[model samples]
Target: MPTPLYQRLAAHYRDAVAAGSLTPGARFPSVRSLMAQHEVSLTTALQVCRVLEQEGLLEARPRSGYFVCHPAGRPALRLNEPEARPLDPAAYVGMHARVSEFIARGRQQPVKVNFSGARGAPELYPAEALRQAAGRALREDPELFVRAGPVAGEPVFREVLAKRALASGMVIAPEEIVVTQGCIEALNLALRAVTQPGDIVAVESPTFYGLMQVLESLSLRVLEIPTSPQTGISLEALELAVHHGSKIAALVVVPYLQNPLGSVMPAVNQARLVNFCAEQGIALIEDDTYSALLDEDVPQRALKALDRTGGVIHCASLHKVLAPGLRLGWMTAGRWQARVEMLKYAQSRHNDGLPQYAAAAVMGSSQYDRHLRRLRATLNLQRRQVSDALLRAFPVGTRFNTPPGGLSLWVELPDRRDARALFAAALAEGILIAPGVMFSNVERYATCLRLNCGNPFTPEVAAAVQRLGELCLTRCRPGAVGSGAAGSAA
Candidate 1:
């Protein structure tokens, strides 16, 4: 049942009082003002004031109406520790090992169906194109095999990437491009270039956990704002935080096909956000990692394209759609092009030329468009099939957002059931999934889970989904499924 109107209204006033917006001895607004502000009935407004008065946030005064009571409770504010401290060189060395461990864990475990990642089918990679490109490079330029490539990246790949950036609405020159191992390195370099140890950064709640690790490594404090799984960040809340001098060095966002939750910000909101960031002097790092996988006939203009003030930093990778092992990624930093490039030079100098050439060959081919079309068709069909399967397999009350395009699904199970528990059970059944707790800041998304629909529709996947469904029923009910199913899960 929906909450009572007066109870909701009373709690709002109580929160305001506790937050110190309505201080002690401050005059309360009249019943008419409350009526106008809340658009509630007179009785409801009176009830709200009565509840507040009883709770000691207000007091009755003769002829003057109610006055705010003294000694309101305010949340305890403490010194926020910087995410990192002055770490010696040893710390950086240890940090690398820690990150390596994270990546290794992601790959070493074999799941029943491997719905843990949004990786595409390896069969779709253009093997023949890569072979031909490597052969041509070796034959046409034998000297290229012995020498080190340019620190910036391969020239042909840079030109292609620049042209594609312009097509996506970014006004960029070839000189502004910097290629790295992949999007991970691209983001890492961007952060190293812009942020310092002990700096504060604002990230969307339930962001990519990989980004969280980056923040941790840098010792950067994270101020999380509630982000809508559909529309990106809450702009008004961001403006408020920035106004309070949050010392936010950058705002990293995935405006196109955001991870875990496939949300695309509308063009109008994108423009508003771009302007807001510019006016507030906050740098916007736009991560378009999944943009290429969009199934839309007309893709939305990227945030970098709408940057009139040179505040948007654009990063993307070919690993998602084309070649993961290629590890080729590029970025266009508007004003900090030099800083970004220097960091890239310091990191790995440049990615291997063979892979870049191979990716470039495939990207530069006629089959590129055909391959994307086929991929989209397959993805769209699979999306429907997976959604239907989930609906049919799981019982009622299982909720998830319906993304227009992308590979993953964000599902919210019944509150009584924990996704971590489901994860343990599924792992035993050889099914692995990304529990939603990993995506959130407060780790409150215990009942949420993300599913991958891009992999092959194997019999293992079918059995895993069926097992997951049965587990859901058992958890949501006291004794819905028999103990035999639970024993099998164990």
Candidate 2:
């Protein structure tokens, strides 16, 4: 469990560079000198030097020794929390164009370091196990490949999902579950089932852009509620909105490992939210996509589990923890099961049976649990590594919250800094990051940003973080200019 010698050496130099002890263009100790100084073997010294080089901290000159090439440490900024802004009336979703442009740029010029999406690295998933499971399912049930299943889903897959739901403290019958293309489709179906055009829906402030797109596509008015990075959506603000005649029809919330913020709602708050929704006749749509990624020993119960009057609709997917390519997602619509089922059928006939059988095969076996255990551990470690890099690389005023269980970190830059500008500058350097303004319907969160920590923090990842830090420092410094130039590139 102790840190490896090479890693420790790398960290020491990384810290030195971050602390200004090692200035840019400064020469690093030779490999032999490093070995003699640290009493480490030549191989250990070489490995440490290689790691530092890979991290963009040290660079090798053709025939010369290694030299510190990274930017010097700047004064740490005072961490500032994003101020909660008032709810803005629903506006036309214009993020589609911006998001599309960002995506197109990434494709046109492939980014060296991608921190834009929330998906886990493919290496973290059990691809071989899933493939074997799918092969077995195909051999056992050949009909699954050729026959179309029911509108809701394949009965066997639904049954497997129902059994799996029990781990999250939900006990629902298989018939109540409806399979969809993914969580996004499930969300669309759930929103369509309970909401009408122009109806007011409450969402967490700084919510995922996908949800905003869904609301926009449906022509729904949004009411942004003040949310805490640590505790999730504020009940007090939500109750006030309801009492003040917001005419809110439905509430969509990501209670566990919320996107962007990575906050988990407390169990007490979860119960309170369910009861409040029931009393107020508001349908609560829970996006539980990341719920399965929580610690196995202390799994948090779903809001659907606490619903007594069937007012909670649970939407979840196995893509994040299992097979992302499968595009498998399910929804349990408590009281509006019929409506959701009908909406799903109308939108798209039942999901493909092939992937369902494949998923079912994996879920039914012990390999699924083992894979989850490894995934949870890997994600946690990756998150820590990224956090360390951010702290060391970013300016002093940078702020961030440690997520309880999630794949991304929400970072708040200095008040004077514009994350959108940083995003542009980073992209120019072949690094990709999610801007905070994309998450909000309003122009708030201009100083905030999100970083994907789902992938393992390899040397390339470390270098990317360092490059971002350098860019941020350049734009945010007291006498710095070119913020406009950075934005112009985008």
Candidate 3:
């Protein structure tokens, strides 16, 4: 008889490792999904993964699931060779720094309304309460305040966070938690912990661009799975990528209210995704950054809540609700907690401890939920405002998604208009919007742009939209001159 399918999978993985194609710290396919892809049973896939684990090619990380291990003494690989550029300190700043600069000093004309942020209005923050909490933390716990914090962050804060997760139906424990500066750092840590340079990671086609920057900085090969604005990446497509021996280190996804597009995966898809990851022995990083803003009668179940095998690394931050300035984010890495904590120690120990205390105080005092409720109401109102504005302002042929909640709206421009150019033109008119090109790994969303709907409706914002409409009209006209003119400098 021919060698069994499980044996074949084990051999394929073994060969990939031997050839250094999969590299170290890469993730394997989930078993249930793999079974579906290969038309095999769960038992066979599990046996294959077990064989690989026993052979030392795969090591299981808690909560993170199984990953290819770096052989002892493997030097940390440098990702990309830095390019020579003008001697400017600002030029070397990372993507977030550039984004921050754009937010602060880039806009020349002062529009009446601001739509540049994917956040609730600044007024949503309980400024007085936070200031009081921070002051109280300093005065009451000077010992905790004046010391270097834990590598995973403060215990009491993490406990509070765990309780919060439990209340939300995520079943996380404090020990599995690692608080970070923000959701971005949590994402960065999980990526760094599981992936080495040259590893291929799978992501949604139109994912958060910042993550693409992370992958590029690490010199990781990116496998883009076609993502639907309504449901998420085709699960079948992802399964195919995994079965073809793609050395995917991890799958980073925002299952609830994904950025830019604002698409949320249904609960059934979420369960299938968890089962697939568990079956394939792969790690998943579930970013729930925007889930807190929903104001629906039926609460959607997070992917982490349905995870039976410890494969989903759940992450979120208080920034979207309580305050972005607080920069308080946490992750439950399940079995990957130790590795993630180690990386946290190696990175910066932690973002800041006092902020955690302040955040916990606000969250625990019952004020946080009330604040979130008000925020949801406000966001809902803004969501309608932007939706109506987009439909009314854009050309009749334009298309976009109307997400139930979240700050950004993904708009597809008519007649293949370059969003980058639109972005430049909008900026020249004292408007700022996220161009669609920024959301793709391969820069494929040139005809799209992400507009922030979190900002309140104001006359200036409406005027900016009208100006943007004029720009779109000009671009859509045939034989338009100088397509290259649209960009940040436009």
Candidate number achieving the greatest TM-score relative to the actual structure: 2
lDDT of 3 by residue, 96-120 (tens): 5444444555455665445666876
RMSD of 2: 10.9
Measured against the true structure, the TM-scores of the candidates, in listed sequence, are 0.75, 0.81, 0.75
Clashing pairs in 3: 29-280, 30-279, 30-280, 31-279, 31-280, 32-279, 62-335, 62-336, 63-335, 421-486
Instruction: Report the Cα lDDT for residue 43, model 1.
Output: 93
| Residue 402, model 3: Cα distance from true site in angstroms | 0.7
lDDT for each residue of candidate 1 in 158-235, tens digit (9 for 90 to 100):
887877676687767877888888888888887877788877677765677788778778887777655666576767
Between the candidate structures 2 and 3, which one is better when assessed by TM-score? 2
Provide the lowest-lDDT 10-residue window in model 3: 84-93
Per-residue error (Å), model 1, residue 172: 1.3
**In angstroms, how far off is 24's CA in candidate 2?**
27
TM-score between model 3 and native: 0.75
- C-alpha root-mean-square deviation, each candidate: 15.0, 10.9, 18.3
